[model samples]
Target chain A: MTTIITAQNLSKSFGSFQALKNVNLTIKKGQIVGIIGANGAGKTTLLNSILGLSVYDGDLNVLGFDPYSQRDELMKEICFISDVATLPKWIKVSEAIDFVEGVHKSFDRKKALAFLAGTTVPLDKKIRQLSKGMVVQVHLALIMSIDAKILVLDEPTLGLDIIYRKKFYHQLLEDFFDEDRTILITTHQVDEIENILSQVIFIREGEIALEADMEEITENWMVLNPTADNIDAARASSPASEQSLLGRTSFIFNGVSRAELEKLGDVSRVSLSDLFVTLMKGDNDA
Target chain B: MIASIIKPGGYNPFKALMLREYWENRRAIFTTPLVIMGLSMVLIIISMGLLGRAIHIDGQSYTLNEMIANMSAQKAQNISTHINQILMVSTLPIMIGAWFCMVFTALGSLYDERKDNSILFWKSMPVSDLQTVLAKLLNVMLVIPFVAIGFTFIFQIFLLIVGSFSTLGTDYSAWDLLWSSSNLPLLVFSELTYMVMYSLWALPVFAWFMLVSVIAKRSPLLLATIPVALVILFETLFFHSEYLARFIGMRLTGAHILQTDNGFGQNFSILGINTPLENIQSAAKPEFWIGLGIAAALLYAAILLRKRSSL
Candidate 1:
């Protein structure tokens, strides 16, 4: 596998507050990596550093270029959709397409127009006139049309309705993702993108709590639903987290043997969101 | 260093950036001049209707029909020259409007993008910060001025056509008198020269406004002005010197490089516009080069600020 992005001892501070603290990370090409965090957990700060939108300390490289110093060259291969709708309100839809096509050598005008053809975005209307959902759709349409090596989406589907959000990921997987490309997404809606992510990095309080491939995470982590009678035995096993609902207790264990957990009760694979909650809550408790 | 920054593989994106600027500011760059011209034309037509058959030039009255009937070659030439001068002077309002448009555009160009967070979108493209800032500066310095000048030339032609229509049935035609004797070519050349000189002279001020736009989080207008106002005030109260005020005044008004000994209001003689050699000589003035150096420094600062400005 080809490593496309690497960060070593990356630190960033805003005045007296530290946003990112000596974090290290690596992402390989062709992986759909989800950067899951709570609000203000340095997800945006990290993504901004990657996009060359902000300065930071220590070493970081994207496509062999320093994102801050060589942003213009790096941008030719990387594209992003920020959390907010950033298209200028004064710009018409067609003009936006015209401008991107004019500047980006890899921008496909017909592809952008084709994407908009499916949506309610009119070519002549200014961006301000569009609904918030349509504004996001327009931004998405613009980004998906670019032939970039990496796509960094910072809450790209934020505030979007369920239907659009589902279609957004579906279209991204079907039309945009390939072996030559990589995707880095940050969102609070962990479960929404869980199925598409090949890998996950859980960030808590500006530090990586866990970084693992989906296969490794699912294989090693298990949710054990212990019967009431065996609850004490499950507790003795020292699970990462415990939750109770409808008088039934469920314990999440990381790296405990599946057979050993099965002895307590029913043992099943853990959902990404459940794992994320366990890891985050476990860190909080610690 | 600046030349080298733009010297390598910068042509296509630079042109695209210019077109993008045109698209964004088409109203301020193109329509402001035309609207000024339209309003002035209407006023001119209404006045011609009210002040019928008597034309006034330089406070001298001439009965239009009789004057043309007995008009001499010298008188015809004088009237033609005055009419041409009137056309040129009429462009003054448009020029003032263009300056206002330029200032407002420069003040808002970079600031508005950051306010709306569209700077993120622009930065997502492959264009360097240098290219973006240069495109904006060019719009203020070259685009607005030339658009204003073009509309002014069109308005001159429109007035000449109206004058020709006024002399429709006369034995002495405006075509023979006004058109033949008109120094339109020299007027155009002179106007071009004046606009170029004015742009160069005012470059630093425009650059300062743009730099303020990049740095100000809000109210860029106040940010651009209040500092200069304070500096001038501080100099008055403490240093008791008018050095900064005079320097700003010279930059704001026409400088010797732009104005000849006869001044702007005089007739457009062939000798009126400075010769190429004289223009080159005047450009060698220390203040002119100093102003350009300041402009370049301010622009460089703007580019650096824009590069790190996440907001």
Candidate 2:
């Protein structure tokens, strides 16, 4: 796969405060990179700097074009989705599509309309009346229809229900995505994305906390729950500590290494949400 | 596999952005200016009827031209003065309002995308920063004027017809009255065209505001306004800050290049509605050309600044 987005020493500051400080990241084409961070962790700032909306002290290349100087060329290959309700408040769904058609030459009207047709959004209804989920669907329809090589979504499914969210990603993967397209999503809905995330980068306090592959993470990280009375035995065997009401326990153990961690009693694999919490709790030390 | 570059292409992104800008702002376009223009016309009709009735009571046998001549001389001075004021107040505010509305209409143009994390969408499009900002500037500079003119022109024509019916004593023909107002379209359009041409001189300011809008996390206008206000405040307290005042004031007035209305100042052997426009058009002043050249330079500078500034 080819490299789609590359960033080096990317930094953003607002007055005396730093929003992002000396960050470095890279995403290969066709890879789904998940950016997990709390609000104000500079996820959006990093994205904006890439899209050329915010000036940052860094070097960034999205599809071989500096997003700032070569925005028009870069935009041709990048599709980004934020909160869906922001599409256009007063416009009818059709008018919004006409607008997209105007701004972007790559916009596929038939596909956008087809996607809209698939939804319950009233064709002639103004966006102001639609529920939040409906608006997200409209945004999804338009974004999915764009023949862009890079798709950037920032909480695109904020208010979406389980079914629509699933359907949204499924359509994205099936209809809009291909082996050549790279999608970088920054969302709080981590578990929903765990299966799709080929790579994950955790950003904290304006710095990269961790960058890990999904398979390697699952292979290396395990959750240990010992029911045996001799918790001290598990504690001696484990490499990482855990908090519990009974006493201090540790999840780290050589016996539960990647090849045989499944044999341990009630040794459940960690979900993305669990992994994220672990990292959030674990990153301060790392 | 294919590469997209910001080369000069036949496609114009600015125009598309402009259409979206206007269409999104349909509410403000239809309502505010129409209300102001409608009220102004109503006042014109009432005042004309009152003036005409007084002429009848005085038993002065007057031609419609004579009455219009009197009105033009007396009320027309106020009318012209107020017309300029109204053009400035009603149209310019509406124009300024339209530009400001671009703030709301285009609030999300790029900011919302970034705020909501959709910059990736816009970045993916085959567009450049110059193209993006150019599209936005075109929306404010060109598209706003087109819509404002379309709305007010139709409303003005409607009022002129209504003003014709507003006549009393039945001696004045509506055709002649309309002819007076009918001649105004060219005057209004030409003058407005000139005003917009001059207004183009100030586009760097708007582009500056757009630059502010894109960067500010809170209110962009406030971010821009506070600094200028502080400078003004600093100058006011100093009282003798001639250098500061001269510097900012010169920059402000430098934008006045398209004032083609200072026509044939006091040189006419003959005078009429037909007179001023012809004199202005015929007597090509060096000032006009000089102003136009300066405005073009400013616009080019704005484009370059947009290109250099990230986002």
Candidate 3:
């Protein structure tokens, strides 16, 4: 697979506080990667650095261009929807369409309009007139119409109803995703997109705490429900996190053998949300 | 080299960016001038009705036409010159209105985008920071002036038609009396040139406003003005030199362009007769060039600030 983004020792600081600390990451083309992090965990900072919205230290490249200096050229191949409300409130739906069509060469205006025609967003109505969900829909339609190589979405559907959120990801996968294109998304509703992501990167306190493919995570990471007598045996495997409830104990282990885990008690696959909480809680303990 | 850096494509992005600027600020760029001109036309019509009713050439009542018919040729020439002067003077409000438009628009150009988080959306496009800032600058400095001039031309035509109607039944042709005596082509060319030169002269101020727009966290207009006001105050308090304030005043008004022999208010003939090229030749002094250099530096700073700005 071709690498679409590469960052080596990338760091960013706002005043005395470090926002991204020596983040080394490589994102390959054709992968739907989800960046999961709590608020102020530098998820937006990382996305900003990759999108060329902020200055950073060390080397960072997107689509073979330095995102900070060569952003104009880089943006020609990359399209981003930075949250739902970033579209100008004063712009009419048609004006927004015309603007993107005029400025972006890869933008297919006919396709964008056709997409909008399927939605309830009015072409003559200003963005202020549209509901938040409709605005996100309009933004999504416009972004998907652009024939870009890389698509980055930072909470593209934040605050949307569950129905719209599900529809958003479903339509995104059905219409926009292909082997030649890559998607990088970050959302608070991790469970909603967990099934669609090929890889998940968990960030904590400006550092990448965990990075693993979904298959690797599913195959290797296990959660074991242990009886009181078998708890010590489960602990020997160095589980990432442990929790006890109603006199039953559960342990989340990262790389232990399934047979070994099975000997302890009932073993099951760890959910991404549970893994994310366990990893973040583990960092807090560290 | 700068062109390549600012605009990767030949010309399409710049045109589109300008069009985008127009889209965002159509009220300031287009509708405001149209409204001002419309109001001026209404006032002119009202005054013409009032004058036709209030005044008479002799004891027997006569409309404005009989008064012009009874007047001597020299007096008619003077009246025509005064009429042309009134038309030219009427443009001053529109020009001032355009200045306010530029000032407010420049102040908000970069600030509003960041405040509303729309800068992220704009930056995601293929256009560079330099192109975006330059488009905003051009909208205020160049495009608005042309729009004001276009409205002014239309208003002038309407006023001329009204003046011709007011002078009906008179031997003196309003065309000959007003239009012929006023060298309109020269007037328009001169006015256009003056607008361009004035925009250039005032570039540093607008550029400074843009820089403040990008840098200030809140109240960009106050942030933009307070520094200059402090500097003026400091100059008066410490050095007792008003040179800075005078320089700013002169730049704002383009006082350097008006000839001392036929200064702005003393000779209304300057409006009709003076060619813009001649005005530029005479007023092409060191301050104008120096202001242009300063403007370039400020614009470069604005580009840098905008590139690093985040919301």
True contacts kept of 1: 0.60
Between candidates 2 and 3, the one scoring higher on lDDT is: 3
lDDT (Cα, tens digit) per residue for candidate 3, span B1-311: 62343222322677778877887898898888988988988887776686664433226675555555644246656765656665676677787788899999999999999999999999999999999998999999998888898788788778678867867765677777767666566666878988888888888888889999999899998999899999999999999999888878777877666644465466434355346776676445777788889989999999998899868
Error at B270, model 2, angstroms: 17
Residue B239, model 3: lDDT of 99
Between candidates 1 and 3, name the one with more favorable DockQ: 3
lDDT of 3 by residue, A1-286 (tens): 9998999999999999999999999999999999999999999999999999899998998988999898888888999998877999998888788778778887888888888888888899999999999999899988999899999999998888999999999989988999999999999899999899999999999999888899999987889998779998787767888888887889998778998888889999998888889988853332
- Deviating ranges (above 4 Å) for candidate 3: A227-237, A245-248, A283-286, B1-11, B50-80, B261-273
Model 3, residue B73: displacement in angstroms? 4.2
Report lDDT (Cα) of residue B233, candidate 3: 99
The total of clashing pairs for model 1 equals 0
**Model 3 in CAPRI terms: which quality?**
medium
Docking quality level of the chain pair in candidate 2? acceptable
Candidate 2 local lDDT, residue B211: 56
For model 3 the local lDDT of residue A173 reads 97
RMSD of each: 4.4, 7.4, 4.5
lDDT of candidate 1 over B1-311, digit per residue (tens): 52342222322677678877876898898889989999988887876777765666568777666556545335765766566667677678898999899989999978999999888899999899998999999998899999899888888888778877767786666777667766777777777777787788778888999999999989999999998999999999999998777776667664656555564445324324444455545576677889999999999999999999988
Sorted into a CAPRI-style docking class, model 1 comes out as medium
